[model samples]
Target: MTTFAPPAGPVTGALPLPVRRRPGFSLEGPFYTSAEIFAEDIDRVFSSQWIFAGTEAEIPRTGDYLTVTFGHQSVIVIRDGDDVRAMHNVCRHRGTRLLDETCGTVGNIVCGYHKWTYRTNGELMFAPAQPPNFDKTCFALRSVHVRSLDGLIFICLAADPPADIDTVAGLVSPYLAPHGLKNAKVAARSEIVEHGNWKLVMENNRECYHCDNHPELICTFFPTYGYEPDEIPPNLLPAYDRFLAAENDLHAKCDAAGLPYEAIEELDGRDVGFRIQRESLDGAGESFSADGSAVCRRSLGGFTDKRLGRLSMHVQPNFWSHVLSDHAVVFSVLPLTVSTTVVRTTWLVDAEAEEGIDYDLDELTTVWNHTNEQDGEIVARAQLGVSSPAYEPGPYAPSEYQVEKFCSWYIDAMNAGEPRPEPAGRSTGESG
Candidate 1:
């Protein structure tokens, strides 16, 4: 077995290295190309950390279930009457996979290979043609730790969690509450497979540094492009606090008004100066808007006593929350290999809201889909460039604080010698 090397730093228990004081702009190259580094990251980061699973809305009815993956492990998220459960999808008898479909309802789970069966609640039910000495009670589907925030589901592979759900919630609650995510429902889903380290995709998502190169998509939303490190907006500086105060204030107002709130939309074209002229590579007329108000109104809606159209927030690591007037959107980045990743996105709305009648979901989906495609194209190319012998790590611009902060945190996690905080309600036995 390959032993993991912690990042460079003084001994601080078993954690990785400490982030350098100077602008640490680049990750070690091995992170992008080494299978050993990938394995270490899976052990240290993905396994111990809280990962966003599918939302509660995906399995709203009893016996409903959805299959997901963490690292290479297949898992199932199921509604067992009153509680939602997450279990390893592998069968105990000879270890054949229990579920092959992505999702479905089965009164009882039956392993096709040996006909081993389990109840929807994860209890071992029976085994056909078993050895006389085989014990059914001794084997059961392994369970993972799970928690729900608003209606979104999170799972942890670690057996012993370092923190409670409320603490984790506190870290992101400010942003989540404003968008009303706790009661949100799923509307649409999409996925993108990219050829690059997962971190590459995350690095791109955390910064608007490439806005200048995106002629059609993001440039339309943010025309003033700046690749220099020094150009960060003052309000967005100190990345962690960027939307905390604003979100808290919004939540307070909602509470005072007795309104069911989830999240706020952060896509007001006005904030980013939508009226500014931008050049397009397609030779389409120079893009210009009279004001951001039109775009915001169309996407979010008018702010009134009863409605506050949209709000957007990002939790450190790799989750993005786009809170629209009547719904919410979430995006997650999952690493498949050192150079491959699976990107998943979901649109959420009120469980009671009727699709097409309550909102035109296609309108909202189109904007995000186009935006993601644009992002994917750019990052894929960047990945190819990074692999080039001529490529070198660059310095950070003052204005690109968001991207810088993300890098800083990633380095800290990679170098920390100690284990990361665990997800809620998990113990070591529960982790694989």
Candidate 2:
């Protein structure tokens, strides 16, 4: 029989969360710098939540798969005919890792350490020299709970993943289905390792307070994001006026197209916090380019107008995406260490769109590529500041409400004995 370490002890054998998070301020420095806290984070939060894996677009074929690794866990997300499945990367026999490449198409999963093989659905297919007495049925690859919401794949390592996802899918699918992300194809993919704690990276994405540093993104994305209309600052009032006008036009267009444009923000007080909306871009009101124009000539979701604005969605702990008339961009964040995080960015366009004829690869990808680089530098500096002994939690501004909400959700998950997920059905606020 195989055995594991730390039978019933804490996985990290670490003390309980070292400090209480102050309301409306950044987390204490140790939360971002301590290995113990990082380990606790993995065992409690990441291991127990519904984490967004890559989109189905990355694995369009029946046998395609992608591997996701964070901390000590690795999962293989594969497409098996009509459904997507998630399983531990470890082989059932001798616990050998079954697949090593980041992603690829595989007829079956075969371990390199030993030749034990499993079918695409993770059923043990062969055990090189096992006796007839050995029960292959007992050794199927351990399965992880997985859900694909309109093509965006998410997996939970926990035995009972948050049931809120069913409700979340129901709420967000109308906003996402029009983009047809499940049937789309990947245009470009990029991965970056940021020099910061995973929380810091998430905080940076929750608000636009520092968007002034993202020149390329700010041109199309409103810098006034997250601010209440009445709280708009004097310096940003002109931009706010432009946003209002664009929103009016966007609403009419959406109505005519039978699309939903209202916002549904549920970023806290639940296990599966999230937000979704279809809002207008600043300039051409199309895509994430300098002029907000459509980068791909071939329209997505059968839309010929090329001006459907942006359908943005954010799911707690680590996932966000924006789907436009021309394409969709998805991001997944995973913790690497106490002071490091890795982010994967994917761009999806119509499967029929030609690289050179219907889209210019550089133009389609330049905005987000540069924006991610700039954010990486910003997160690195934030990490450096948090590591210093003089660091202290600071207050959040009114415009940074979502950052506070994100922190609230993070703390609740970290401190949970059994997370209270939002029930299977929610009508208002998407509440628990």
Candidate 3:
């Protein structure tokens, strides 16, 4: 197996620091306009990188299974007796998809075209009308690397394991473990199809630089742009701080507030932290602040660590996790064409938390879905505008560091000349 190397530090003069007294930016023209670049991206980026498949909670039983798409490939995650396995969702008989449904429990996966039976564990258990000399062992389902982190599931297409999932988990565990993600359950799921590139969706989610345009939906929750942790309401800050600042007393407060205790715990425990800094925009009509100090506001209010409310996180590339004190939601981005992307968002809650009793997830879902639709409209228009012959790559606001980080990461990965594996981490085991 080929051992994976962690990304190296920025070499001297390799990536120069951003220009001073002016915003700095770079845009590779072909990334958004060329079909060839898109194809290469699928192979080098999506296929190799860890892609969210599903949650282990989605398939709790021995025979439980879920079918999902990784890029254009069909894959299945199933429970096989005592082991959980991920395999290509293809029938050996005629290369047809074995299971067409999104999710379910099955005794055996039997192809509709021909009666080829495979155990839930992905072993070719039975095959009808095989020649006397036929060997079933060689025909077993093709296996893919699978691992679970918290409850999230991830799968990689490459034959050799790219990197240690545990290492990846260690990096983000401090941020996720406190939220009870390890034990969380799926409460609901929804999808949206947008008319823009997948990258556009990611860029939008990476920074909160465009929230005012849709204030009615976002301001109800996150009402301010101040970065001082104290400037925000205790309920608005992540939970970990409460644990440290107030001892365990905050845990009770969080529980009483209906927030996810573990998430807050993780946030507080994290070595590397996040801060929200904002700067008011002037009349120049730019969406961001002149100094890039502030982010755009949208439906900011949701859940926080204090209660099962709302919080948002961008997990590099095309995945996002939105945590509400009571529940959590995840989103995956799939690019269909240069100008089109399909987004799937799923809402998760504790299995015991009844929908209406604990919280109205649908209300939260409606708000977030609408927010996504609004983003779609804006990004689509942006795509059209950028495609104009007169357009030039503009400067990045200094405060828009998240956006800068994202663009820098993408460029670095592309320049590395190697396949990008799923962000190194264990899967949550849920398939969307």
Candidate 4:
């Protein structure tokens, strides 16, 4: 048995982190390759922020649970009776991890080390050979703060989680509600350990300047992703023209359905940074299939039109999603080490859609699966380059505005003593 222990203090003669980044530039090399900075990120940014954990579709029935482990922390997001709860995975008796599997169904959580048992609701159910005076109530599993914005689950390790999630939720729910994610079911989920810092993985996601590298994704996903109207280069003019026509058609559909299609971008200057919009896909203007047609026959949320476009949302510091008419795909980033991070992607479809009947599994997952592998390669290469001593912070192109916003949010969260502005109101416009 491999027993896990907390990490020791930093080694002597560690390089000091660059405290602040030059505005509108990439972060320094240490932010992507230093153990000390990685530890600080887990302690400050991830611990303090509201993290996107998973979806309610993950644990649908009582006793169903999913375990999320990042750095030295592990948490269980479980279904108990009618509610979903998050609790520390450590056992009260010997600090043994209660769950080993990434996800499964369990009648009771039993610590393998000492046989201590806990109920789905995290109540202490059994403790063998205990003193009669031992109070079980006092030893219930320590609960973590959890919130479900519609069907999307988020967890916070800190006791006092930021309240801006409520404000962000209010703005996005109108855009997301029509998709009816709560009623959807997990069609497929994949996890890959990318050889890169978590920050590198996120930075890679914030811009489409690298879209040419993703052949499969760029077929349906617009190549003009992060570019402003005036900033798109002549090389991408053809793609931009297609985007405009598809967007106009998408707006007509959204208006008829009363769905919010305008973007609500509030990426920085707040505790909960997010950007969401219902925009058009390329090809057939439907799902993410090779030909851009509906991957599933049944539309999620009872939409009759299969060409409803994609409702895309990106949330810092570690989540993003694309909701199509027939299906949705979600991504979560979890830091594993200074140089390795796990990216989990899940595909969701209508609950009634059967695997062989309504959708073929490979067709449903092909595009994003290829895109994720491409991204993993890009991040690993970036990590290798940044680890070299010659690497330095570089200027971000004007099209990479979201990447800059992400860096700004990260820096603000890392400064524990600094004061930040109130959560900003949602703006109805493109971020870049």
User: How many angstroms is residue 70 displaced in model 4 relative to the true structure, after the best TM-score fit?
Assistant: 0.7
What TM-score does structure 4 among the candidates reach?
0.92
Model 3, span 1-432: residue lDDT tens: 111123363322122122111124535444555665565456555665566677776777777887766345778888775567899999887789888776788888888887899877676878888899888887888888887766677776666544645655665554455556645556676666787667777777765547665543443333233224454445545532432334245346555654333432121112112221111122221122222111211111232323222344544456666554445667777777777777877766666666666646545466566777788898888777656776566766543456666565555444433443233354334545
Candidate 1 lDDT score at position 328: 58
Alpha-carbon lDDT of model 2: 0.88
Taking the tens digit of each residue's C-alpha lDDT, what string does model 4 give over 1-432? 111111232222222453458878888888888887787778677877988899998899999998988887899999997899999999998798889888999999999988889999899999999999989898899999998887999999887888899999899999888888998999999999999999999999999888899888877898888889999899999999999999999998788879889998999888889999888999998989777899999999899999988899999999999999999999999999999999999999999999999999999999999999999999999999999999888999987899999998887677641122223564343555
Which residues of candidate 3, in runs, are more than 4 Å off? 1-23, 81-83, 220-312, 417-432
Per-model CA lDDT versus the true structure: 0.59, 0.88, 0.57, 0.87
lDDT of 1 at 358: 63
How far in Å is the alpha carbon of 95 misplaced in model 2? 1.5
Off by over 4 Å in 4: 1-18, 417-432
Q: Give the TM-score of candidate 3.
A: 0.70
Candidate 3 C-alpha error for residue 117, in Å: 2.2
- What TM-score, computed on C-alpha atoms, does each candidate reach? 0.72, 0.93, 0.70, 0.92
Q: Name the 10 consecutive residues with the lowest summed lDDT in model 2.
A: 1-10
Where in model 2 is the C-alpha error above 4 Å? 1-14, 417-432
Error of 2 at 340 (Å): 1.4
lDDT tens string, model 1, 1-432?
112344435323343332233354655456666775666566565665566677777787877887776456777888988788988889987888888766678888889987888988888889887789987888889998878766667776778643544554554455445445545566788878878888788778766667655443442243333323255456435432423443455467667754444532221111110011111111111111222111222222222432332344554445665554455567877788878887888877666666666656665466567777887887788778777777666776554555666655555444542344344665454655
Q: What is the lDDT of residue 162 in candidate 1?
A: 37
